[model samples]
Target: MNNQEQNMKFMQIAMKHLPEGKKILDDKGIELNMDDLQPMLELLLNVMSEAYELGKEESMENKS
Candidate 1:
């Protein structure tokens, strides 16, 4: 997938799990805030994107 598609997919996956994450934090007496999570979420997106690229490259190399 292209960058935009990859980002969208990553965001979808993150959002899917966000409620569970919030619940875990809530159970631990931690408050979950979107503003506080923005930076962390960005970092996670970057990591996921990079990992996807790396895996794609590896797959292509294996097919060579």
Candidate 2:
């Protein structure tokens, strides 16, 4: 597929997880109210950020 198509597919997959934000937070040891999911979503973002950074660091190490 073309770049645009691929991007759209990836975005769709990502957005499907919007409702699971709280589940992700719960799995990662972040407690939050079920009524409000933003906190869990924020925690998920923090987790993804750290994971991405770690992945980049590993890639750099492998290249060296």
Candidate 3:
């Protein structure tokens, strides 16, 4: 697939898992403050990016 298709696929999968991410924070009593939401989102995206890369690497290894 092309880069755009790959990105769309990634986003579709990510959207499905996002609720679980929020649930984890809710369980921990982490309240979402609008004032700090942007930074929190940035942090989440950064971590998710690293995690996706690691997962992609592992999946490629499995295909070898």
lDDT leader: 1
Q: Is candidate 2 or candidate 3 better by lDDT?
A: 3
lDDT per residue (tens digit) for residues 1-64 in model 1: 6789989999989888888888898999998699987787888899989999899899999999
Residue 58 local lDDT, model 2: 100
Off by over 4 Å in 2: 1-14, 20-35
TM-score of each: 0.85, 0.53, 0.50
Q: What would you estimate as the lDDT of candidate 1? A: 0.88
Q: Give the best candidate by TM-score.
A: 1
- Write down the lDDT of every candidate, Cα atoms only: 0.88, 0.65, 0.69
Give the residue spans of candidate 1 off by over 4 A: none
Candidate 2, run of 10 with poorest lDDT: 6-15
Instruction: Summing lDDT over every window of 10 consecutive residues in candidate 1, give the lowest-scoring window.
Output: 32-41
TM-score-sorted candidate list, best first = 1, 2, 3
- Residue 30 of candidate 2: its Cα lDDT? 82
TM-score of 3: 0.50
**How should the candidates be ordered by lDDT, best one leading?**
1, 3, 2
